[model samples]
Target chain A: MKKRLLYFCKSFKINFDELEIYDKDFIFGVLGVLVEYLSGLLMMFFIYDFVEDINGWSLDQVLFFYGLNLVGYSLWSCFFINTITLPYYIQRGEFDRFLVRPESPLFQIMMDSFDDDSWGELVTGLIILCYSWIRLRIPPIYFLALPIIVVSGCLIYLGISIILSTFSFFTIAQADVANITMEVKEFAKYPLTIYPKVLQIIFTVVFPIGIVAFIPGMVLFRQIPWQLLLVIPLVAIVFFVLSTRVWYLGLKHYGGTGT
Target chain B: MGNEIITVNRLSKQYHVRIITEGNIIKRIFSKKKYKEIDALNDVSFSIQEGQYVGVIGNNGAGKSTLIKLLTGILYPTAGQVSVMGRDPFNDRIKNNRNIGVVFGQKTQLKWDLSPLESYDLLKTIYGIDDETYKENIKKFVGLFEMEDFINNPVRSLSLGQRMKCEIAAAFLHNPSIVFLDEPTIGLDVFSKDSILRFLRSIKEESNVTLILTTHDLEEMNSICDRLIIIDKGRIIEEDTIEHFTERFTCSKSIVFCIEGDIWKDINPIDNEVLIVDNGKVIVSNVRKERVNEIISLMLANNTINDVQIIEPNFTEMVKKRINEGD
Candidate 1:
């Protein structure tokens, strides 16, 4: 584990240097993150003013859920925005260089940038999360649940991205597939209870975005019978392992050269 | 340098494809189709010495790149064994990679958004080179490649020739004992090609770096390579020293002259093929270069010679003739 940590650190250092190479690219990345945060907050405000509460939950509870998703998306974007462009890189044959390196390509792509744009969302997410926690007057045990939720959310998002990007190995037109995956993931922005029960079940079992947002909210709202926060880490680990397996399966089918 | 840095025994690779179709919505959902397998590499075998500059010459789709990919561990061989530097290239790649430097002419390994210097530094970190040693090597390569003017420029902005030089430099950054260059001089101007080839030759002479070069330009083979292998349809048709290959396969030498009389046609020399005839002009082919003087004497005996020229077959023409002969 220590050796793996050391390797990850070195790889991250390389990625940081790559990030610093383009000053304008860094600026644009930061701008993107900030814009995403502000727009999310604005949408949350409008929804709160009109709906008052969602599914018998108060405004603070919905804001807590929104903040949870914000934290989730921010963390995911922070680690993997660069990886989203992987299909383009694959088409240009640039990804071959990454594949030949000793380190795993997934790690290299994941750590490719610091993602300054996600910082805006991250800061706002923490503030909203803290504010809603105060308004709800949740106990300290739920505070312990926050990190679990965030980690699981990142895994779910990353898993989806990997499955979508893997389509590049087989498809000549994968842009539409990428769009549809992200668009469907956007459905998880709302509370799962607000969705149909079948979709709620589907999201819980198949996609598991609820592990990041809804289940954590259930623990805070005291809606579930037991403390469900413990399940977050298990889901994160399982989903991450499966995503990595699928990624390797896709790579095995990749023909390394041009058509 | 010994005679085997790379050894291959019956290497082959095959790829399978599943056919999918778009019919009516229901049929598209339910239909299953046949699958096909494409054999990209056949049971091929070869070996290279440690310091020999070997060139692989073949037409396109001859599995040249596939062979390189298999040997470099970028792709797995379906059957047979390929050992580079005494390690199985596919199974134990990282250890094997430590001793080999590879350059793909069509692709680059450098960080796309980084400057050449930054990418080189990053490689220095990954390769675990001491800072002082890395600095010395970087200085040497920068000077050799004339990359000082653009070392700070992002790789995306450099010209093709400059980027090619950087790619070559990146491949050698770790100082590997074996260097594989696949069409390293393709699409470069004469000046750039000359510099790269000169640097490669110097590396061979100064260090015991084995070079495996693949290019369609046999002139590249003639100038830098001592050994040659010619492949067609995933099989090596010819392999020998450059001199022997030239002697056995090169078909003709040409002689040109301006006769004093206007006897353009029907001038015969002993055991020579008349290839060109024009007003006050005559040309003969298939004569040995050693018989140039004799042919000149015969031409002068027939008519006063205004001028004389002798031409030996160049490497490209010889390779073209070999291909035609093989066909």
Candidate 2:
């Protein structure tokens, strides 16, 4: 694992010292990250200014949920956006190169491009979380638990992206499927308590978006319900394994059209 | 002389694809019925002994690319099997893949934004090549390809030939024993093409590395490949030693001679079989290699020969004529 991590770092960390800031991908990366960060901040400000609290919780709790979502979502965009665009690569015959590499094609595809836009959202989300915790005078343990939530949330999101991207093999037209995935993800941006009990049950047990965001938020607030925290890693692992299996089966059908 | 390093047996590939046609909105809505199955490769089979140089030639969509893809393990065979170096190409182990290098003319493996040196360093780390070996190979290729002028330049800034040279260099950085070059010299200028061909020939001779080249450039095959496999319409039309194939296909020699007298009207060189005839010059009919001396003696005795030019079958013409005949 240590060797694999080092290999990943070597492939991803190109010498930026020689790169101009005006380079198109670099500029686009910055713009993309900034837009997401600012949007999350704006949404936080709106929610805090309007209602004093939502769903039996203070504005600070809501901000915590928002921050948690952004942290996960931003990290997903940072490394895993390639999964969302698998259809385009397949149609254009670019995915064959990934298949030929020694590493897992999913790994290569997930790390193909890092979205700089996610950095802004990640920084802003952290700052908002800290400010809210300081304002609410929450215990230092909440701060200690923050990294755990973010890490688990990021893994869960990564697993979701892989599962969605794997659909491109079966569904020849996959852009609409990706949009549907985004819509499902957007529903989890808020606390689950605000939705109907049926949706809350489905989101918590069936699809588990609530487990990634709201449950982690609840854990931070010391509303720790049962041994659900242990399930986070398990969920991420199960989804990741299943998606990888599907990706492998799909690769068997990969007839690389020559250019 | 040695065991076959690569073996392909009765390989085939089939694909189901949908291509929607432009039409009225109503037709588009209800007529979602446009799917077709294409058999890209049909029961193609061959084997390559270790360190052998082979050239695969065919027209567009004749299954050359399909065969290469199947061999490299990028595409699965609908039937039969392919084994390279005694292991399946699609095996998920890095160890199995480290022995092979592949370069596609249409795709570049180098990072577009990074300098060639930086890309090389990154690849070295990923492939876990030690510092000494990496530096030694980089220095060697840099000298051979005259890449010093642009090694530090970003790949996107380099000319096409320079970039292609870099791609080839990067593939060999790992010192793979076998290399698959698909149309490597395509679109290169004459000088670049000559340099690349020389580099390839030297690599094969010096290192005894196996090379499988696929291209439409018959000149490349004639100069570099000892064995040739011609594919037509998803089937192997012919596979033989390049020498044997050329000799078999090219049975006649064409000689054009400028004569002093009006040879067109005076001499009936085998009836009206003469391909070209003018006022005082004549282009003789194709004579078999066995009858070359007889035709030349007859021509010399009948007329005053000013200048004569002998044309044999060129590789390009032979391939085109063979493909046309097969079709």
Candidate maximizing TM-score: 2
Report the C-alpha lDDT of model 1 over B34-104, residue by residue, as the tens digit. Answer: 66777777788888888899888989988888888887777777788888888877667557776777888
Alpha-carbon lDDT, every model: 0.76, 0.75
What TM-score would candidate 1 get against the native?
0.83
The backbone clash count of each candidate, in order, is: 2, 3
Q: State how far residue B72 of model 2 sits from its true place (Å).
A: 1.1
- Candidate 2 lDDT tens digits, B51-141: 8889999989888888888887877677888888888786543555677778888878887888899888767766677888898989888
For candidate 2, the lDDT comes to 0.75
Largest DockQ belongs to which candidate?
Answer: 2
Tens digits of per-residue lDDT for model 1, A1-259: 4534554575567666666666678778777766776787688778878886778877788778878877877787766756566677677766666555555667666655556556677777788888888988888776666787787887787777777777776654446454444564467767788888898887788777765777777765757854567787788778878877887777666743223
Candidate 1 residue pairs in backbone clash: A30-A117, A33-A117
Residue-level lDDT tens digits of model 2 in A48-81 = 6887767787877777776677777777766666
Interface RMSD of 2: 3.1
Model 1 segments more than 4 A misplaced: A1-52, A112-116, A139-145, A175-181, A223-228, A255-259, B14-39, B250-285, B288-310
